[model samples]
Target: MKSLGSSCSSRAAAETPEASRERRAGRGALWSAWPRCAPRDLAFCMAALLLFCLGSLFIQLNGGPPKVLLELRNYLGESTYLDDHGPPAPKVLPFPSQVIYNRVGKCGSRTVVLLLRILAERHQFNLVSSDIHNKTRLTKHEQVELMRNISTIPQPFLYTRHVHFLNFTRFRIEQPVYINIIRDPINRFLSNYFFRRFGDWRGEQNHLIRTPRMKDDERYLDINVCILENYPECSNPRLFYIVPYFCGQHPQCREPGVWALERAKQNVLENFLLVGILEELEDVLLLLERLLPHYFSDVLTIYKSPAFWKVGNLTGTVKKSMPTLEALQVLYRRMKYEYEFYNFVRDQFHLVKKKIGLKSLLPISSHEPSFLRELTLHTPDPLEEEEEEVEEVEDDAKNWLVQP
Candidate 1:
């Protein structure tokens, strides 16, 4: 009986070691088959990460954020006019915005207005054309009329017109986002002079002086002669109708001097959100579209070919013979104020673009938060608070303007 008990104890002890080894082997195999993440989930995660990075990059590049924001707000993976259930978390989307476009004539206002109209249609945002019908742009008269009543505009609109900035300055919202385009002052005057004769709005103005002494196609009004003779409209286009439209609506803006020049520059920096030059319209539009895909994405479609530019290219203006140095000098003198303002506008536009960190960029997704801030994190301050802040900015700008 003693020998039998000792043999059973040795057999049980030996089996215990084998049982432990089998259990360890089974646990190792189960862990080896288990995945850190399913393939679909892993793919989704990678895609989400990629989008968030891209969205962040876009906002960072556009220095004049308003120019690109309203248009791109839809894609920032937040709640937009198109989707209340914007992309999933981590996507930082901006709130709905109001934009005002002070569309100065012959400064690519048509293209800008058209782009806004298309954006309005696609995004279902309210676009206020005011005077002009949906099909055509506003005439000069209509633009002026719109300016008189610009103050009555409701909040949250993308209002456009070929009017001066002053007209809308008092009428805008706190933290207002104003945008305008400017052309070379001299060139703009010349273009308008000729365009009036050959393009459309000919013989309708008080200044037009068509004499029997000119050739048939040379719709040279006496006003053109007066303009060449060192007059603005015939000598001061600002007093009549002109560029530097970003200057406020005050009677002084149309008067020639450093005051209007400084005011225009200040407005561009402090008030206007974006100021684009006519020569660089295409590239700027491209930049705008990339920065604000929602509003300007379709802008490039109409301007697909350079041919769109040709329709009005050098029309009614002398094409072959360049203006002589003497003529150019005389013209420059007449438009010195305009030229100065134009130069300032051009410089300011580039400066703002640089400030906004303009660059070649690609749009990204906003579904992931690790790559960017939740856009919804941004809540604009109360309207009163926002106004106070803007007032501070304006005060600072005024001080700078007054400095010697």
Candidate 2:
């Protein structure tokens, strides 16, 4: 009976150790699951709420995406007057990839073409040659053929030619920007005349070497005779050149009249991105550097510095002597429209310089252009004078009504 009782006690002790191990194993699973499930879900919900709040604030401030881009104002510290809505539109624009240069004759356009070639060489843009090589206002079919070739010439190409301005859409150019230079009409016509006569009358042809079989000017033996004739084909045909070039190559614009003058001015304002004057080539260089940095990044430096401007005054093409006073008078009379167009362009350039506050173009010590400086010596435009008179009268009337 004693032996049997001792054996039962040992069996009960062995069973107690196995029951304790099972209780510890169940507690380990609950501890691991608490970290992986409930806390993670709580963190995710808080992040989502914070993102929603930030997105809502942005939408309220900017109105909407389309307007936000259009209204983006470059603040040099919160710019000019704005209504309760917001600020005015911007002026600083991104760079352009393609460009069209409508090269007017004897306007120092060759210099600009040289700059484009330099840009193409450095920046890897294509400087394409047009199929129609003639400078005279091309016939309609010739214009179409040249434009057709240009439209499909591929990206990053700069088209430089003595072509006149026409509607870009008619030629299928995508987002084209036009640029040109104009000279004093008298100077422009003279350059072309002597250039044909003496093949660079400056006695230096090294600047632009003549190719074999170059055509000589036999239009007239004497400069005076050329000017005296005032023929459309001969004697400095200024009427056929300046205004018609800007007014498009159409026949209507070719006729010397007010219609051509007005049309040319309108097209320049609407189509041309920039227009430069030949007399102020330095200003042109500075303006180009500032406005079209991507294309003319180092024009002044790489293209022979300030001295280059003086060398190309007449582009190695001024005659040893000039025409007689009477002949010149005849030339200017025929080219009255050219003179008006020249003055208009020069005035517009000055206005741009003033508005932009261009510091690099000219020095403070520099004087105004002779023409503008001596405005009192010349007759004012009748149209502008009438406008001034009307404003004066309106002011006097207002003063009379307000008198106490």
Candidate 3:
């Protein structure tokens, strides 16, 4: 039995070693035959998976999520909705950088200009006040040149002149915002009438220097005679002064008729940002401050300053007299167009005042002929003082004693 057991044990050990070797060989063959993944193939598969994730993220960001995804998100307690309305509204326009004040004569422009000088300094804006007061109407070539010059002025500038309306748009130039002031037609006429003769506080000699060619007879002409006798200075075309300032450079603008009147009113509506009345001078300055803070901020404060009043009190036109009631009535009839434009401007101004939450000291009034009669009945005394410098003299030739 011992001999048989030893032989069996030796056989089993040999068999066990052989079986182990066979099993190891089988495992090695199976591993080699199965798909062998190279390092490059594994890296390529990972790169493809990464790129697909990135592309889906890009699509989600730009085109918004897919409808199914959006619905899934909403179902999962996310409250999101798309705006299927039209495209967003256009952006608001930037503020105006260029402003123009083609000022009308004898209408408190001097006062406004004086305030502007101080304002320009205080607010750090460019104020270009034209020295050419005589040439309100310019030729076409001249208009082109002038508009070019004004355009060349630096941005955020305010240019003022005693000039008629210039169509910058017609000249293919950017139009600057416009502003102006006007007074009662008859009042403006009277002020110019006396200002040409005696001038202001500088003395009677001031008129002589301004109107060197005026004879003593014409200089000293009575107001009643000038209007009643149909003198060239007081007649239709000449008395048709203020409208031309608003009616542009068209030749017909100088004519006192419906055409010029309607054109002037249209220009005021389309071009002018504000056309103030001289009677409401304070309100004009306030509006200026509100509308153009960069250019005219604190203008009313400077205008109402004690030092400004001191300078203003020292200046007044000498020997201004109102015409007789009959002469005034005749003048009113002749200036029918002027009064019509004036009334229209006043109404527009009052509307603006109401818009800006401003309380007008001068209430809106009727446009009847009775208004003129009432004006005559309550004709205030001639100006005892004015708010312009003594050295600032308008061209007497343009205002009086010259045919258009």
Q: How close is every model to the real structure, measured as TM-score?
A: 0.51, 0.59, 0.69
Q: How close to the true structure is residue 403 of candidate 1, measured as C-alpha lDDT?
A: 36
- Residue lDDT tens for model 3, 1-404: 56988998887787877798898999999999998799999999999999989979988788876688778877887533334545666534326778899998888777777878888788777899988889998899999999999999877789999999999999789998999999888888988899888888756588888888999899999889998899999988889999999999998888888998899999999999899988788898888788877887777788889999776654566787767656876787788899888989988988898898988764645444323434444555445464232112222211221222
Which residue pairs in candidate 2 collide? none
CA error at residue 318 for candidate 3, angstroms: 1.9
- Count of residue pairs whose backbone atoms collide, per candidate: 19, 0, 0
Provide the global lDDT of candidate 3 against the true structure. Answer: 0.81
Worst 10 residues of 1 by lDDT: 366-375
Residues 1-404, model 1: lDDT tens digits: 56988998887777877797998999999999987788899999999999989878877896535655677875675655447665656533323255677677666676666567657787665688646422223444554555555445544456775556643334342444677777666556555665555453323432235333445545544543554566434455443344346666666766778777887777778777677777677767866666556556667776665765554332233321223324444565566567666666666666656666764233222211111121122224549758777556434433432333
Query: Is 2 or 3 the stronger prediction by TM-score?
Result: 3
lDDT of 2: 0.66
Task: Show where candidate 2 strays beyond 4 Å.
Answer: 1-94, 129-135, 171-175, 201-220, 229-238, 306-315, 359-404
The lowest-lDDT stretch of 10 consecutive residues in candidate 3 is 390-399
Top-TM-score structure, candidate number: 3
lDDT string for model 2 (153-229, tens) is 65656787777775657766564677788987766777776665555634556323543344444433677765576
Give Cα-based local distance difference scores for all models: 0.57, 0.66, 0.81
User: RMSD of each candidate?
Assistant: 23.8, 17.8, 16.4
